[model samples]
Target: MHGSTPIRASRTLKKSHANFYRAFHDYFVTHLPSSSLHPDSRSSSGPHHQLPRSASKPHTPGEGPSPAPLLGGTRDTTVVRIPLRSAKHHFGVSVSRGTRPYNEDTYQAGVIEVPAFAKPRPLNLTRAPANSPLEAYRAKQREEQEKDSGDGEGTSAESASGDPQVFYFGVFDGHGGSECSDYLRETLHETIEETARKYDLVSTLKGKPQTAAIVSSSSSKEAAKDTAGSATEPAKGSMPEPSISKASTLQNNLLNSWKTTVGGYFRRFKPTAFASPPETPTTSTVLTHAFLQEDLSFLLAQLRLSTHDTDPVRSDAPLNANDSLYSPTHFPSSDPQVKKSFKGGSTASIALLSTPTPTPFWHPSTPSTLYTAHCGDTRILLSRVSDGAAVPLTTNHHPSTPSESERLRRWAASFVTDSFGEERMSGLANTRAFGDMSSKRMGVSAEPEIRRIDLNPSEYAFMVLVSDGVTGSVGDQEIVDLVKESKTPEIGAREVVGFANEVSVEGDNATALVVRLGGWERRSEGGGGGMGTREAREWRKREAVDPRGRMT
Candidate 1:
């Protein structure tokens, strides 16, 4: 009876949601001001002078059949600095971790299944403010780089020759106005990359490759437990082959992985944190060594520096997070309260590409990198154009994953539960995301499950990244099809966004960014565009567009 009730309620919920979408789609936007096309102020940031399109003429790397509507609207914020250490340790390690604004009302959705060949990566890195000096430097470098790599030289298609090419693209799906998505749009990729570099994950992965350790640890732990009994011997009829790496008794669930590594990163350990203003404890060098006994010497050393302790709540200052979004920390400051008086957040996915490394048994052609990160349903879809089929790139993280929920179940240990004494379950809320910090214990995960993947140059057409606005109502497969089917990725992207918006309507701010091989063209000489006669600028200023341009 209880199960039946939930099933009925789910159906009703779906019906209501469908109705809402239908109504929203039918209602054409009214009062769509140029300012609506432009941006309003931000809770955490200042306004921008102009959009990217305004600063430079777009030299589309990939072109397609049509140029649909362009998504506009944005806000800018101060440059964010993510610890280089964290990013490297947690490559493809999920959460584009941040100090998210604490809030309630929020919305997000999308699908993600990492490319089989590629491991999951936290698609996040630190970002510079829209117009900061660092931003200026980076932008200048890109212009020079693009000119050298993309100028009329016929080799545009393979611009990424052997050397690492920094590519930028993002899908910012906004719900309550384009604020959150726009913030992400302006700052997502740079943040992800910077964060990734910090952790120096390439070294971390090599030091403790997740796979070999799991196989060895499980074999050791379970073998000890089963020595007396419960060891299901190999079927006499089918003897097991002699492979050095045997699939042990461990369940292929994410939780088991936690018992060894992941859980430690999330929880507070006795690290040597630097002292605050209050009476700081002076730690003698000898005492610190004892604390470092458990391969956590580095961590303990850090703690001593800061009066370290577990329980993030007890900290004098909050766990270090993005500088701009610094509301959640426990520290008291003279800094004026951030004017951003709104409650909102976003579900984001981030990743980093790495150089190939050698593995014990497997001969991988590409870098065995980590994608430690969290995300909304907004997924990362990877494709290898040579095969002509889109491939899954990372596991879709949601409240639905039993393993993810299990981690939370353990976390809820001290809290009271049902009459039957079962631990309370906060499973339905997404297990990981960026903006849903208010729902941290329930709706979000502070830690991200870093997955690994290899990038193979031989078989990739590039990746297509989008937010829920683009994929929620529209099928994920359809978006991939659009990208692959189109002649070039730019048109493919524009068409994909247009179609997605057409299906979901204005309420869902949809955006698509494609970073792929080329068919790039030089910027159109800024002049009277759109055929010989009616100038493009005059047409917009006077609503006097001529249909004659459509003729030729």
Candidate 2:
């Protein structure tokens, strides 16, 4: 604070305020109608899209010519969601997390990737006509694919069973270490499953359960270990799973019930599931695929050990316990028994598409769930086709949020300084993350602000979820217009990524993943969460096509 001259300091403060304005620019957006669609996004290779808003209505599922849903699959307790567009598809992502190296006041470096998700959708992907720019463009796909085909490849069917066709895919950007990222990638589904199996019973608690309570008061003392605010809580793995209340688990139960309900739909109405003559769609339609990205980088501690720390948070665990992401050559451990430490962590935002089952009728040709997490600012900036205009779908968990600040206040009562207390950084080094345990002691949390959106006609068109890397300088509503004004989702992603990079200062790892889903039948009574009349008719049309969401 002392090194700045008066004029320089004034300018610095001005830029900081301006940056914050860029970070949160909603009031500036002009209200627009939903009918207008930007033409540039579709103008093959037209400079990356950059607009503030567009009034585009959600695409009606079956009524118009549209792409299929970008993702599909089963919904149950075992599902974990991330939003990471694949490499080949027209997907892009942007990431800018962490305090600046010299200026901890702002984000330094960031990463941005295009066409965030290369998901399989209902559209046809037969080499875009002939002589198109894409056909003319060249990349070393052959060599890359061959190289990536080996073991330990970033993508393998290690956990995939039956088909690797993802129903949903997401990105995990880690800051402190890859341990947390790896943990989520490997066990998110299991965690979801466990949460579902154990948590569903609570939802059914409105009535007496068919079985006696396994987690009773007799086990309350035992339950102390797994409780939310346990002072002497064990590490994640060591913590016994006696069970507790949380949203993730709630989602698990809801999914399980739906599965049971659907299974019954076929069993009770065997004619539909086991018809004799079988059924065929009246028309022919094609399918395509999409993909998203994830952030699995060197950890801070690992960086520290190797000139950077090898590992930071020391915990006795099974996998990758000591597989330090960064190298810590010096510095003390933030937590004892570990290598060096870091001041902060990273967050990963991914949006993936996949097929959960073989049933047809869904739009994605697959099902997709949006996965947005924050560690070091690689985020998925998505605006829902709400009432045709863009409505923010993801919540940025920052220090300024009231509830978040409250949680920290309670967590950091004894540790507060005169200024910069836990309360001061609610959205600042706040709760929920992909990394940053250092912030966690001040109660840096890891509760992701996740949502499962079954693309529907009502919530039509696709969305663009950029990171602070993109949105930081750009206002949220401004981003809405950029995509809305664009002609295609692909172009929109590229355009935004470019603009974000230009505005970004030094030390920013800016990455962007843009996902434009084709045809989404918002969950109606049958496949969607609830049935809207428009959504219902859309489903009926798909039933005319696939039946389950697709044709058997």
Best by lDDT: 2
Q: Model-by-model lDDT, in order?
A: 0.33, 0.34
Per-residue accuracy of model 1 over 431-547 as CA lDDT, tens digit each: 444433234433244233333344433344445666655665556556655555454555666666665544443335455655442111111111211122223323432332333
Candidate 2 structure lDDT: 0.34
Error of 1 at 410 (Å): 5.1
Give me the displacement of residue 247 in model 1, in angstroms.
31
lDDT of 1 at 329: 28
Model 2 spans > 4 angstroms off: 1-90, 93-164, 167-343, 352-386, 414-428, 485-490, 503-507, 519-552
